[model samples]
Every structure is written in structure tokens, then in C-alpha cells.
Target chain A: MLDQAFEALKTYDWGTDVAVLAPIDEAVVATSGDSASREQLERRLAAVLAEDVSRDAKDYVCRKLMAIGTAASVPALAALLPSAELSHMARFALERIPAPEAGQALREALASVAGSQKVGVVTSLAGRGENESVAALARLVGDGDPAVARAAVIGLGRIRTPEAARALESAKPADPQAKLEAIDARLACAEALLAAGKKAEALAVYKPLAGPQQPKHVRLGATRGMLAASGKKAD
Target chain B: MGGQHQPTRRRFLQTAGAAAAAPYVITSAALGQGAIPPASERIVMGGIGIGNQGQWDQEAFLGRPDVQYVALCDVRQSVREKYKAKVDERYQNRDCQTYNDYRELLAREDIDAVHVATPDHWHAIQVVEACRQGKDVYCQKPETRTLREGPLLIEAARRFARVVSGGSQRVLEDYTELVNKCWSGELGPIKWINVNVGPLSQLCNLPAEETPADIDWDLWLGPAPWAPYNALRCSGSFATTGGSWRSYVDYSGGGMTDWGAHHFGGATFAVDVREKQPVEIEYIADPQGDHLAFHYDNGVILYHNRPKTENLAVEGTPGQQREAKPVPVYKGEGGIYGDFIHCVKTRERPFRDIELAVNTIAVSHLGTIAYNLRRSLKWDAAAQTFTGDEEANRYLDRARREPWVL
Candidate 1:
């Protein structure tokens, strides 16, 4: 039944009856306890991604990989990262693969993809909280594209390490909108730092943003962050 | 600071008093015309996702004399126009604005609060963004789509000091009888409770259809994976079966979360464990059937779909009675809606505060993961992770599709 499902998958496209793929779903549930079976299923599903299947078929495989894919499946998913039609789903799996190789695949794609695709890769790296991508994300914080630069800014905010915070502080996005996003991201980084008990680091970020030159809301957030970090409450 | 800032009524009054020597004209509109409260006294509001429940929420807010509904947002052009027309009609003018994007509406400096009734996938993002924008939120349940989203939602609300109310009236009203019985202490020392809610969401492969011009399909599928535009795949119907987004894994947790939000919310509140998440989930597969026993730190267990146990069933020691305590109820005049508006005005926590709401949904999400893995698991609530189970831990959250981050 699994083999039949795989065969059917090669021709699967949007609008097709999804019931033909029920055997794959059953296999996902059935092999939960059987490591050998689960690994075999993962390999088979990964192989389908490299096949001449419709985008829908590969999407199905990626969804399954998201559940059970291992390091061995990372290469196949990574191969699709440069394809705009397939990059999002590929990251969808790679982002949650629990394997370092998956994060590396996304980082490598940073140099290979562009526009919204690159933005997607940046987001996945941030979503995984991959400390390794901090430098690459920092470099993109002032990218020519406002969307990419803004995504990189928010990505660093999510990364939230002291290094990421520093990168955010130094980022100089030429776009007005990106500059605003930088402030929001900086405040977010401070909150994250404060939550992690890095009081001094959090205060360093907050104190600067809380200055009179900042917007009322930005100053408000920074003030609140400073109060919380200093074990005080805002009245 | 870059945009125009609208001072609150209190701030306005303070400034006005300080400038008493200056000549100023107070129009009837500023003092509030006829039946409506003054502009300074009313809560300026906006509605996101004005579909079935969104419309109902809007109507409730419109009915409040203290609320000034000013904006409506929906991805569907038809829905946006229809609701905007309705709001304009209610105000006897064309003052209400409409937007296809929620971000644009959230950018308005004059809007004080928003009620978000978007699909489950958009809930956390919208709520968190609203918090960042300094707007109080009344978000519809289930408050989160994943276990990881629960904490982020709560953190955003707390970090911004925003009043966020969960949109589950059933948690208090529908289960009042059971809640009263438990709080009354008639059945002393409750040991366990059963909440039978089931049939997890499934994968969707609905065939491609012509994308309707009325809706921005990509925005509708925000954060979720790209699927072809099919009416049934995005239907807002109550069904957890194949017809609606509720039935799809990408958009919802099926009935396990859709109705689970209400059922488990009621069950946990009834059992007085509304503030806690189960520390462990034991998946049992007997010859009779498969069920789950969720163990709380306090020795209370929440059973999910245990065979022969009815929904919201509580097992307690009958002979020994415990001390009765006053049941918690909504604070303001109206039900959940009024409670939220009142809290927004008073800076108090609403009845279904975001933290409690997140905890209620956590039960459903944990149970769903347990069933998906088909095994028992230990949850470290503080860490919000599975104990030593990497495979199970991977399910904590999924990678959201491009351009959307929480």
C-alpha cells in the first residue's frame, strides 16, 4: 500500500482526491514506534522530492518529512530551496527537522535565493532560533530590498542573543519602514534579553531607545522594559 | 513618535486644564452628540475578519454605548464592503473605514482596541501584533494554534501591558452548572474529569479551483502552507470534517481544538485547573479503545475521550465535603464582551484573560500531540518541552510560511 501511494504521488497535483494518499498517512502513524520503519519511510518520502512529481506531490512529501525526516533527508529538501515555487515548503520541513544540517541547508540558501524566497529562508532560520545564522541575518539587515532587510531585522530580534542585539543596534536600513521595524525589533530583543535574565544587556538596549528623541510608543516600550529589567514596575 | 498621536481623554483633560486661559470652542460632537458617549469617553474599536463570528462580535461592540466602532478589516472584498456598510449605517454616516489588510488597520493611531476573529492560524500573529501596536485585543478562541504559540501570545500581552480577552463565552456560561457544582464543593476532592472532544484535523488536497476575485487567497492562507484555492478548504463552517479549514491540519486542530477550546476549557475551569497545564499525558491503548489520561501536578487528571465517560464528567469523593468557595465570574455588565470592554477601561484582567485562555487550549494541543505520536509523554510545563523526547519535541510548533512571524 505504501509503494502504491508513492507511485500515485508521482502524478498527484492540486485538486486531485487526497484519499489516494491515505496509506502514507497511515504509515506515518503506524511507524511511530518502529524506528527502522520510520527511517525507511522518511528515505522513501525524501526520494519522491527529487522525482518528477508535481509541486503538490513534493509538498505532500515535505509535510511528511516535517513529521519524521532526519539528517539523511536534509539534502533532498535543501535541493529545492532555490526554487521559488518549492522553497517555502522545503523550509517548512527543514525548519523543524531537529537536525543541524537542516539549519545549514537554510543558511546556504541565503546566498542562493533572493526576493521573497530569501525572506522566507531568513524567517525559517529565525524561527529555528539558529544562533549560527546571526551573522548572515545581520549582513542582510541593510539589504537593498526593504522586505528582506526588515525580515532580517525581525529575524535577529527573534534570535535575541547579545550578539543579535548588537547587530540590531548597528543595523542601518535606508528604508524608512525598515528603520521603524528596527526599533520594534530592538525593543523585542530587549524583552527577550530581559526574559533570559541578561538584565544589563536588556537595559543597554532599552535605555538608548527610551530617550526623549524616540517616539512616544517606542519610549513607552523601552521604559517598560527598563522597569521590568530593573525589578521595578511602571506606574 | 513619527505619526500623529491622539491623546486619551484623561490626557486631553489634563492638557485642557493646564491651558484654561486659552480660548477654545467645544463642539457638540466633541462633547458627544445625542445618545453616544463623548469621543473622549468611548473606546475607539476595529474589527478584523468580519465573517460569521466577527460580525457577531462587531454587533456586540456596536450595541455598547461606550464603544465607537470605526474600522473593519477582512481579506474578502465582499465581506469587507458588507461589514463596512453595516458599521457606517449604524453610525448614520460614512465614517467607518475598510481594509483588506489587518496591518494597515492596526497602524491607525486613533483606534484604541481591536477584536480579532480571524482563522486559528492567524490568531497568534494578529494578537501579538495588536499588542505590539499598543491596542488591547479580544481574540477569539482557541487562542493558539500550537503549544509554542501559547506562551508567545501571553508574553506579548504581558510585555505590552495590554488587556487581552479570549473569545470563549462557553468556558464560563455554557458550563456554569458544572462549574457551580465543583466550586460549591458538593463533590469533595475532585480526582479526575473527562472531556470527550476528538477527530484531529487531516491533510488537505482539495483540488484547485478558480481563485475568487472577492478574496485575497494568499492573505487568507497567511502563515499556513500554500494550497490551491478551494471554497471548502477555507469554509468557515462549524464542521470539523473535510469541508472546512477547521478540518485541515495546516489551519486548525480540527474538532480537537475547534470545539476542544470550548469543551476542555469548560472541563478545566469546572475542575479549577484552569490556571495549569497537565504535567504528563498517558496514552492508553486497551482492547476497548485508545484514550488519554492527562496528569496535573496537583494529582488531578483530565481524561480525553476515555471510553464510556461522558463529556465534562467529573469523578470526585462523594462522602467527604470540602469548603465551598466563591466562583469567579465576569466583572462587568455584559457577558464576555462586556467583561473585556470593562477591563479595557479599568486596566483589569478580563474573565478569560490570555493566560487562562492559553492554558485551556494547551490541554487540547497536548492531547493532540499525544494521539499523533500514539504514546505517553512527560511535559515540562516550565520549559514547555517534552522530557527527553526529541521526536515529540519537534511537534511543539511548525514552521510558518513566509513573511509571517510571531
Candidate 2:
């Protein structure tokens, strides 16, 4: 039943209705919180993931795995971490997986994936806001590959902790694109700080960028940031 | 979904798999196509004023196989050729045409519609001309640079019976979705709506710079009175914000109307003010720059640039205000580009149709005029004029350049 739902999932887009997934979706929802039912679904989904089913079908099952997944579902999702076609959906499941094993699986693959793949893993870590991954993120902040380095900068912004803020302030990138990205990331850290109620620390981040001495775009952003932060309370 | 797959939009969807993952993508299906359908239902389009926003508008349509950009136009020779080359390269043919003037592009009988990405000053003239030529228009926001021109554009659109859409697609998301909730009284008679984007544009004062050889300075200054060409004014898109031409009163209405049209476009959906206009407009004091406040006959107020939040804020009755939450920002699925393609096929009026655009632009224009004159103004919405205010009335439209008659 779920396999045919995957077949319909492969054919859908924004232009049409997705109601065809209702029957299998009802089955999944009916089995909610039942470990035995979830295990069976995950096993079936894992088999389909390995088959030549369209990436959309795989993405659909991975999202289902996100809701009812156990540590048992990690291997099927973790196998996709290296695949550009499937990694995003894999991270979608991994990010929501409450089990520590899901995170451990991501950390184990962190060292092996390179280029954009590494960037993807780093992004998943940030999305999970895994504080344990901060040191790993700091090291990649200045990676020689600009895409990797830029992704690391954005990742630090997403992690949004004081440690992440400090890492962003200290990391340096040689490439101009990466340098611009670092500047933007530092501001992102400041926003994260504001969101966390570290008002003075956030203002401190803005002051230097606001000075006339910084680049025009940088100064403009900093000035606006200060103006916006003046009296508004963070919710 | 089989054989002799020519290039239709839905057909392109199945084959173009997972090119890039977007936060906005509801399905990978929006990204790819497997069966290219026949060309009989294909929408042929021309892109006018292919500059910054023009290129952004063009980019959305370029990827769709059903909509083909047969002609490109721009005052700048370099910008037009750059787009021409891009269109040619994408189609793998030299059939894509180029023109310096928008009117010449509108003359092509083969084209079904045109997307207007020109500056504010040129919006009404270009949109009207395209409509007069029986071409549907997808025009950029703040529908007119001046108040008086909005009606004229709408008049032309109605007379031609063209499917005219204002380019603010944010209003297209279920008229965008939250409005339905607002109308359902879920927000309990919204007391005040804060349409916060940013402050209005001030007068242009930058020192003029030498015109570049590649730019046709004369053609770029079309319709609007001549001003010295500064490179800053000529440049487009800064760090993802709207382009530089928006800063000048002579060219665009600055930040206020540019984004105001979009945010208010959403706000009006909630307050249900499509046909009626705000009875009064006033500029409230700000230490940095002035912001606008408009009062409706219904006693609901609309504030521009007064809120801290970027999204439209609906403050309901006391208890509701205490419980209010930010709305999901509306972005049309497939965006305005997709909406236009759908409208072209269905022969339906788009949600952000020209008159709706005129009403929102009028609200922004009222705020802008009040800011410029530094005083409150009484409005006669039916008259489309200010009540007993002569100086404010002068701002309705500027005198067109001698040869470029409106």
C-alpha cells in the first residue's frame, strides 16, 4: 500500500493535488507510536530507497521515517548522506530523529564527506543545533574549499550560541567570496545573540561594523541592525 | 504523459530532477518534468526593460519550457544583448530577438504577453502600450510612479481585456492564505494592520557622474524628465535588496512604495479593502525618517513602517492582540511567473490584477505625497484627488517630457 503511495509521490508537483497519498498516510497515522508498525514501515521504506524509485518517492518515505523513526531507521537515512540526490531528505529525517544514535551517525560521516557533501553534513548539524558539533564546525569555518567554508560560516550562524559567535569572529577566509560570507555570518551570530537576550553582546558585534571605516554594504547592514535593535524587545 | 514530447511547462517538470533544493519547494515535482507536451498550449512571452528587476522576472520564466521569451528589450545596449545571448544559449538557437524600445517588442504579433520590469517612472507608459497592443502584462509593483497614472493603466487594461497582473506575487498565495483566516473573523475584526517594510524615499541628491558608453542614457531616461546619469543610479541589485534607481523621487518612490506595495498588497487582503480607498493619509513623526498612517471609513487603520516586524501585523480585539502571532509570509507557488502562466492558459484575471494593484499603489502614493508635503491630506477616493489641497494635488503626476507624451 505504501509502495504504491511512493509511486504516486514520484509523480506529484506543486501544480496538482497530493491527496492520493491519503490511503497510505492513513495507514502510517493509524500505526503511529507503534514500534512494530513503524519498524515494518521503515524496513519497507529502506528497501524502496535502495530501489530505482524516483528521488521524490524516497523523499516522501524519509519524511514519514522522521515522524515514526527509531535508531533502526538511521542506517537507511545515513547511507544517503553521501548522495546529492538523497542527502537532503536523509538530513530531514536525521535532524528530527530524537535518538542520540541518529546524531552519532551524522558525526561519524562528517569526516568522510568532502566538498558540497561535507557542507551538507555541516548544515544538518547546524539545523539540529548540536552543540557538541561546535568544534568540528569551527575547524571547517576556514576550509580551503570556498563552498565548504561559506557553508560553515552560515552553519555557525544557524548554531547560534556564544561559542558559535566566537568561532565566527575568529575564523578567517582568504577568498573574497568567503570573506564576504564571513562578514555576513558574524552579523548572523549577532542576530542569534539578540534572539538569545545577549543584548549588549549583540550591540558589541554591531558597533565595529557600523563604523564608517567598514565597507559600504557592511556599514549599511550594521547601521540598519543597530537602528532596528534600539528599543525593540526580542520575543 | 508520453511520446513526441514537445516543451510544455508541466512536461518539463518531470524530467528536470533535483537541480537544487529550495526551502520553498513543496515537491521535487515543481523542479522537473518527464513528458514534454505539445506546443499548441505553450505561452509565448516577451520581456520588457531587461535590467535588474527585469532580469529577475525573466529568470523565473526562463526555466519553464512552456513559456518562451521570444523578444528582449532594454535601453542599455549591453544589458539587452547580455539577455539576448542568454535566451539564445538556453534555446540553443539564434531565434531570440532584441530591441532597444519596449514599443517595438510590443509590436510583435506572435507574442501573447510581456513582463514589465522597468523602473517606476516607466511602468504606466510601458504597461499601457503593451495592453493597447493586445498583450497581457505582468508588471512590477507600485504600479505607477505617480498617483494619476494608476487609473490610466487600469483603463487601458480593461479596454483591451488583457489579463493584467501586478508583479507582487506575495498576494497570490490563496490571495495569500492568511487573508482567508482574517476574513473568517479568526483575527476578530482586525483593529489595526501594520504594513512594515521601511521608510519612504527622499529626494535624490547624489552628484551626477559621466554616462558609460555602453548605456543609452537618453533611452534610459525615457518619459521622466532628464537628470544627470550617475553610475550609482545606473547600478542594479545591492546584496539582494531592490536596485538603486528606487532611491530617486524622479525615478522611483524609494523603499516605501517599492516594498509598501507588496506588504500592503497582503494587508489589503486581510482588511478586505479591494474597491474602497483610505479616506485620509498622514505622515507621523519619526526621529530617523517619516512613516505613514492611513485611516479608513471603517475605522481600521493601516500603518506603513511603524512596526518592528517585517511581516504584516494584525492587531485584533484586546484579547486577540494579546494572543496574536506573526503570519506565514505569502509567496506564490511558482511565484508570479507561475501565476501568469496559469492565467494565460485559463483566461482568468490574476489575484493581483491591475485594479487591485492600482488601489494598493494609490495607498503607497498617498503616503509618499503626504511625506513629501510634510502634512496630512484629506482624500476623495472617488474623485482620485486630494480634498481642498492644491499643493498636494500637484504631486498626482509630473509633466511628461516633451517628446515622450503620456
Candidate 3:
């Protein structure tokens, strides 16, 4: 039944009867506890990505990889990261694969891809909170592309490590919009720091932004962050 | 981290003085000649995803004398233009702006609040972003698409000090009788309750069709996995059976979350567990069929589609009396809508506060996972993970398509 499902997947396309793929879904569930069976299934699914199958078929495999893929499936998924049409689904699996190799593959794509695809890779790295990619992302905080720069800024904010906070503090964007994004990201980083019990670091980010020169809302956020960091209440 | 505090309205009223100073014409409309409030006193508002529910929410806000509806946004050109025209007609001006992207509307410093009726997938992103932008939110029900989104949404609201109200009128209005019974001590220490909802959202494989000119297909599929543009695939119908985005796993939890927001919300509220989530979910496979039993830390169990049990059915300790407690209701006038407006004016948490709303939807999501894996599971609500179950944990959240992050 699983073999038939794999055979059917080669022809799967959008609008095809999903029932034809039910056995594969069942196989995923059936192999839950059996790591050997799960690994075999993962290998087979990854191999299909290299075959001449429809995009939908590959998409289906990526979704399955999301559930069972490991470092072994990283190479196949990473190969699709350069294709504009396929990068998203590939990242969809790599983003959740819980393996260091998947994060490394995404980090490598940072240089291999460009435009929105690069933005997607930065986002996946941030989503996984990939601390190793912080320096690479920090370098892009002032990228020529506004979208790429803004995404990098927001990604660092989400990462929320002290190093990520420092990256936002050091960024010098030419664009006014990017400047505002940096402030927002810094505020977000401070909030995360305070929550993670790094009061000194949180206060460092909040102190300067709390000044009158900043926007009213940003000042308000910084003031609140400072008070919380100081173990005081915001009246 | 401290108790939720309600800020006074005096500070807002004081800030309005500057804007009030700029106006000079004392025209009839300026004075709010009829029953309407003057422009300076009105809550400046905008609408996102102006489709079925969005339209309904827009009408409710428009009818208010204190709400100044100013903008409409939707990925669909037709929907936004149509709604923009209606707002312009109602206000007797061409001032109502339209945007295909919600970010532009949210960027407006003038818009004090926004009501979002976007699909389940867009709820968390829009709501959190709206909060960050300093706009109070009146987001539609099933406010979270995944379990991971719940805490983040709650934090955004609290961090920004925004008044976010979840759209679930039925929780209080529809289940009034049962809620009264439970809270009034008429049901005597409720042992368990059953909420019948769902046939979990399935994978979508609907064939690709010609992309319509009226819709921004890419924006419509924002954050969700890419799929071909089929009309039925993106249709805003309430149906959860392959007819609309609601039926697809990428977009929704099908009825499990669509109506589950109402049923599970109503059930949890009735049992006074609106602030809590189930700590354990026991999958029951009986001769009749399969169902789920969710155990709360308070020792109250919520059964999802239990065998032969009617919806919102409760089994309480017979004839034992318990102390009555006050049943919470919407503040101010109108129903849920008015409650939101009132909270926006003052800084009180709305009746359907984001935290409570997220708790309500968490039940639906947890049940969806258990049913998918067909096994009992343990949940640590504080940690927001499945204890000792890596496979189950994978379903906590999915990787959103590019440029959209939580």
C-alpha cells in the first residue's frame, strides 16, 4: 500500500484526489515509534525530490518531511532553496526539522539566493532562533534591498539573544523606515531580555530609547521596559 | 506580570485637547446635530478582510454614533473597493481610503482601532502586528491558528497596552442559560462537560485554476503554503468540507476550530475554565466511535464529541449545592462590539480578552492534534508543549511562508 502511494505521488498535482495519498499519511503515523521505519520512509520521500516529478508531488514530500525529515533529508531540501517557486515549501520542512544541518543549509542559502528568496531564508533562520546565523543576519541589517534589510532587522528582534540585541543597536540603515524598524526591533529585544532575566541588558537597550528624542510610542515602550527591568511598576 | 490594570480615560481625554484645538467650524455635522458624537470624541476605526464577517463587523461599527469608520483593507480588489464605497456613502465623503495590504491601514496613526476578520492563518500575524502598531484590535474568533500563537498574541497585547477583544459573541450570548446554571450553583460542582465539534481540517489538493484579476492570489495565500488559485479554495464560506479555506489544514482547523471557537469557547466559559487549558487529553476509542476527553488542572473534564452526548451537555454532582459566583458579561451597551469600544475608551480588558480567547481556541487545537495522532497526550500549558512527545510537538506550529513571522 505504501509503495502504491509512493508510485501515485509521482503523478500527484494540485486538484488530484488526496485519498490517493492517504496511505503515505498512514505510513507516517504507523512509523511513529519505529525510528528505523521512519528513517526509511524519510529517505524514500527525500529521494523523490530528485526525480522528475510534478511540483505538487515534491510539495507533498516536503510536507511529509516536515513530520519525519532529519539531517539525511537536508541535502535534497536545500537543493530546492534556489528555486523561487520551490524555496518556500523546502524551507517549510527545513524550518521545523530540529536538526542543526537543516539550519546550516538555510544559512548557506543566504548567499546562494537573493531578493525575496533570501528574505525567506533569513526568516526561517530567525524562526528557528538559529543563534549561529546571527552574524550573517547582522551583516544584512543594512542591505541594499529595503525588504531584505527590514526582514533582517525583524529576524534579529525575534532571535532576541543579547548578541542579536547588540546587532540591532549597531545597525546603521540609510533608510528612515529601516531606522524605525531598528528601534522597534531593539525594543522587542529588550522585552525578551527582561523576560529571560537579563535585566542589565534590557535596561541598556531601554535607557537611550526612553529619551524625549524618540517617538512617543517608542519612548513609552522603552520607559515601560526600563521600569520592568528595574523591578518597578509603570504607573 | 502584575495584575491587569485599567488605565483612566482622563489621560486620553487630555491628549485629545490638541486635536480638538485645530478645528474651528461649528457646523451642524461638527456639533453632531443628531445623536452622534462629535468627530473629536469618536473612536477612529478601520476594517481588515472586509468580506463576509468583516462586512458584518463593519456594519456594526458604522452604526455606532461614537465610531468614525475611515478605512477598509482586503487582498481582494473587489472586496476592498466595494466596502470602501459603502463607507464613503455612509460618511457622505470620498475620505474612506482603501488598501490591498493591511499594513498601510495599520500604518495610519489616525486609525485608533482595527477589526480583523481575516482567515484563521492571518489572525495571529495581523493581531500581533496591530498591537505592535499601537492599535487596539477586535479580531474575529479562533484568534490563533496554532497553539504557539496563543502566548505570543497575548504578550503583544499586554506589552503594547492594547485593548484586544476576540470576536465570539456566542460564548456569552448563546450559552447564557447553561452558564447561569453552572455559575449559579444550579449544576453543583460540574464534573464534566461535552462539546461536540469537528471533522478535522484535511489536506487540500484542489486542482489549479486561472487566477482571477480581482484577487491578489499571492496575498490571499499569505503565510499559508502555496496552492493554485481555485475559487473554492479561497472562498470565505463557513463550510468546513472542502468548500472553503476553512476545510483545509493550511488555513484552518476546519469546524474543529471554526465553530469549535464557539462550542469549545461556550463550553469552557460555562464551566468557568475560560482562563485555563487542558493539561491532558485522553483519546477514547469506543465500540461506537472515537472521541477526546480533555482534563483541566481544576479537575473538570471537557469531552469533545463524546459518544451519545449532545453538545454542551454537562454531567454534574447530583443534588449537591455549591456557592454561586457572578457570571461575567459584556461591559457598557451593545453586545461584544460595544464592549470592545468601551474598553478601547478606558483601558480595561475586554470581556473576550485575548488571553481568554486564546485559551478557548487552545482546546480546539489540542483536540485537533490528538485526533490526528489518534493517541492520548499530556500538555504543559505553561510551557506550551506536549510532554515527552516530540512527534506531537511538531504540530504545535508550522513554518509560515516568507516575510511573515510570529
Candidate 4:
């Protein structure tokens, strides 16, 4: 049955781009068909996850497992999350499943890595937009590394859950760059609230930014948003 | 009857005897002829442009019994006579057709496939025209002269569902295993790839020799800008194939496009970077001034001109018996012919897919653009246009002369 899936992908009308990708992806999809049962899925995942394959094959496996989206494979995907060698596709797949167990696994994974990988994971988790994920991102705003903390704060604004906005309000900026980023994060938070259909609250968030001290473009954008929120035109 | 039935189980065996006799079985007429007919269908072969490379190609195809040499075409009578004599002597049959024009040769109903060794400029038109007429093609390397020619050739082949194979076949060896090995991430994520090949420069810098009476200088120039015949450019008598080929801007992309098309095809396949174009390119002339390197979005650096220090060492671990001799970095030989036959049977893409050809042409054109502008440039893959540059687009596709437009 797994072989059939592999064959289908090979013969699939993937156009030229996907056809080039089929061979590696076929193998990963084939592995997923090992068994629908959680026990068998775990066993197959253990064997299929190899750090040594070509980057193409690794990416293929990541996409395939992510597409499966079974809670059963979450443990296996989570296990790989801690490894710095894990591909972004694999990390994103884990984020997509978004089970409480998966979120906890991702938090643990983020705690273990350093540098860009950590930033990537934190950003990915926040992008999931889970309230738990937003809170974690907000906490990262105080991380010792200012770049990471700034990324975390930006990620929180992107997440835009109510919990995230509250965390951002209370968090301290580490430097001038961080201060500028906080303003951007606040703007993002306001926009995300508007997108979420909280028109009154979105206007309230934007009203405070109508000041000369702010970047000219940001101040103008804030005033424009406030007027649009109140159902009036701004020149 | 059912009182005492013993279980019968099928057992598999690998017999050394049968293994040893496998070759003999294939060679045996009775068994072989029963399963597959001997001389079942003749592969009718035609040759166009019987220049030095074209003549050599004829001999290669003629060496096979399956290929029936039906037609030979060239602008020169001497070339026609030379191949006709060789074919007649070998086959002991004088029923072969000869023509001075390739269009006449392509028009024949009997020819199944054509071997096109025409000049760089004529490749696209001849190949596309042949495929449109339902003829499979074996075109010589560089596949096209410019970016504009690649898609036309690819579209023509695909529309006709014809088997059109490039002349460079090295990429298909062991399925480009070594190249794939590099992409497989074993080479520590390729920091650089240096091609020992570069452009075929024009030999017109030398004093012009008189045009030979027998050569069709006009046809030889074909779509290239017309000029009085220089013996050095037309016959290539004074230039080494590499030196002459690399120098010519009109006929070739210096070795960069010619050999780069073949080698870079493998590099892209191995790297799994077939889709994205190189985001940025900067050409560096050597202090002694021998070569150039093309950098890519994926951090892969491809150098052509002179060999670089990084590409000199072998890539992987030594074999069991000895320290690993450097695996050869590139393969250059009868790559075009060997792979064409394989694709014909297997119905699979030859190592250089048409898409790769298109992308490689786009990449190769960068060098020409750089040389002409005498500066580095940024390529925008999304816009399919160079950023902040209108002058560069002019060189991307050259205007075909009268009577030829793609």
C-alpha cells in the first residue's frame, strides 16, 4: 500500500517542479503507510528519520510526515525537534499538528537549541497562534540575547492573541533597536486585533500612537487606522 | 488419496551454473530469437552538418548494426563524399541519399531520427523543425545559443512527444551518481564547484585567411552576424577546439556556456536546485586571468575558466584497498550519443532535461551580459528580469537574421 502511494506520487502530475521532488518525497510518504496504528507509526518513524540523508530527502520526509498530521506521529516529530540538524519543514510540520503534547515538545525543543535555529522554532511556534504559544513567545522577550528577545517580541505581535498583547505591554525593551521593534510589535498587534474583528479595541490600541515623537510613517499609519476604526475619513 | 499427502514448499535458489551461462544464453540464437526478434526494426539514422564533430558522430552510429544510415547532409560536397564512401564501404550498399541542405535531408519520409551537429546558432531551428516533422533528434551540446532558443526546443519536443536528446551524455552515467552524492549532503554542503571548462573564443583576432572555394561561407555564418569569411572562424584550422571555442562570442559562450551547460546541468540536479535561478552573479577574472565563478542563491559557487584550488581534491572517503583517489570532478566524452540511445529505449529524460537547458541558458547568458557590460549584475528570478537593468535584457535574446526566427 505504501509502495502504491510512492508510485502514485512518481506518476503524479506534479508538473516539472514537483516531478523533480517526487523520488525523495515518495519514500517518505511510503514510510507513513507502514501502518495506521500509533505503535507501528512510531516504529516506522524511528527508522525513517535519518540525519544522514541528502537535504532533499530530509525535506521530503519532513513534508510527508507533516502532511500525515496524525497525533501518533507527533512524538516522533517532536523527538527530532530537539536536533539542530532538523529541517525547517520538519519543525513546521510539528507546529502544524499543534496538539498540547506537540506544543510542550516544541517548547522543550526551543529551550535546547541556540542561535538561528532557536529563533526559527520560536517564530514558527508563535506563527501557530496558539494562546500557549503566544505566552511562550512573550516570555522570550526577556531572553538574555537581545536579538532573540526582539525576534520573540515580534513573533508575539505576529501571534496577536489577547494574552500576547498583555505580555508585550508589560515587557521591558533592552535597547533602542528593541524599543523600535516594540513599537512595530504594537502596530502589528493592533493590526492583528483589527483582523480578528475587534474594531473598538483595535482603535483604542492605535489612538495612543498618534504622536510626533513616533516615526512619521508609523504615526500617520496609526492615525489612519484610528479614523478608519471610527468609520470616518482621515486626510 | 488424502491419507498421506506431504507438504510441498517452493524453494528459491541462486545457481552459479546459470549465472555463469547467462551470457551464452543471450548469445544463443534459438532462445534469444524466440523471445526477441533479431534485427526486428532498423533505427534509420540521418546526419546533418558533417563537420569534424558530425563526421565523427556518423562513424559512431555506423558502428552499430541497428542503425541504418539512410541520409547524409552537409554544405560541402567533400564532406558528403567522405561519409558516403565510408557508409558504402562499410554496408556495401549504395542506396544512401545525400544532400547539401539539411532541410532537404529532414524532408525524407524514411529517416526516423537525425543527428544534428550544426553550428550553435542553427541548433534550435533544426532540432525544433525535425521534431515537428516527427523525427527524434540527437543534437550536439550547448543545446542552444541563447536563452530564447531553449524553451522553443523544449516546447517543440514536448508538443510532438519526440525524443530529443542533447549531445552531452556524461550526466547520465551511473545516473549522475557522483553528482547526486554531492547533493546528498555528503560533501559537507558544497562550498564551491569549479569547472575546468570555459568559453570557446573566436579566432578572428588572427589575420584573415582566404575563404575556401568549396565552403558555403554564408550558410556557415547562418544566424551569426554576417561578415567576410575568416578561415580561422569558419574552418577552425588555426585554433584548438577548446581555445577557439572559448574565444568565440558569436558561436559559443566561451567555454562557460558550451561545457558549462553540460556540467552545470549535473550540478543543479545533484544540488536539488533545479527550480531557482542564481540570485546574484559576480565574475572574477584571475590574476593571471584564466576563469570566472558564478555564485548562486544556495551558496553554491560554480567557477569556469581555470581550475580552482578547492576543486582539486577528491570529495569522499578512501576505498577499502587504498586511500581515496580524488573522484574525478567532471566527465567529458561521447556523452551525447550513449545517453540518447538509452533515453530512446527507456522513455526517460536524458540527464539534461529541457527545463535544465532553459535555466542553464539563462545562467550562461549572465556571463555574456557581464562581459558586455564589463560589470557584475543581480538577477531577479521572480520577475524573470534583471534588476535595475534594461540594457542587459537586450543580450538575453538576440534577434535572428532574415529567414530565421524562433
Q: Which candidate tops DockQ?
A: 1
* DockQ of candidate model 1: 0.55
Task: List the RMSD of every prediction in angstroms.
Answer: 2.5, 24.8, 3.9, 30.0
lDDT of each: 0.87, 0.69, 0.87, 0.59
Rank by TM-score, highest first: 1, 3, 2, 4
- Mark the 10 consecutive residues where model 2 chain A has the least summed lDDT: A10-19
Model 4: per-residue Cα lDDT over B1-406, one tens digit each? 0001222110011222146654443333212244332322445689998866787788887776556677898877788888888888876779677888787777555566799887677888688667645567887777788765665677566534567877655544533566556644566555665545444443232333577877777677665544455555555332434335335655766566666666666655555455556876676655766455566876766665544454322233323222222333222224556455556555566555555566765667776667545556688765555777544543455433322323
Q: Model 1, stretches more than 4 Å misplaced?
A: A172-181, A212-220, A233-235, B1-30, B33-35
- Angstrom error at residue B239, model 3: 0.6
lDDT by residue (B1-406, candidate 2, tens digit) is 0112334333443333323443253242233246433343457788988878789888888877777678998988888889989898887789788998786787665677899988888898788667655578999887898887787687566534568888887664634466766765677767878876645653343445778888888778775544567776656543113337777666777777787777787788677775568999977777755677789888888887774644577777744532334443323347667777777677677767889889988888888778655678899988788999654664665534323433
Per-residue lDDT over A1-235 for candidate 4, one digit per residue giving the tens place of the 0 to 100 score: 5544343333332112334444443444344335444345334543455434433344445545554445666666766655545635456466555356666776777667767567657755654556777767777888887766877876676566667777788657846445645655676677667768888877776877666655333465578777767777654
Clashing pairs in 1: A15-B207
Which 10-residue window of candidate 2 chain B scores lowest in summed lDDT?
B1-10
Judged by whole-model lDDT over C-alpha atoms, candidate 3 comes out at 0.87
- Model 2's A-chain: what TM-score? 0.76
Counted clashes in each candidate structure: 1, 10, 3, 23
Weakest 10 consecutive residues of candidate 4 chain A by summed lDDT: A9-18
- What lDDT score goes with residue B19 in model 3? 63
Which tens-of-lDDT digit does each residue in A28-106 have in candidate 2? Answer: 5566446687678767766666776655567567756765666888988899888865676676677667677877888
lDDT tens string, model 1, B1-406? Answer: 1333546544564466456563265445555768776667788899999985899999999988889899999999989889888898887889899999998988776788999999999999899878777789999998899998998888777766789999999999999999999999988988999988868998888888999999999999999988889999999998998899899999899999989989999999998999999999999997777999999999999999889888988988899887898999998888999999999999899999999999989988999999988889999999999998888888888888777766
Which scores better on TM-score, 3 or 4? 3
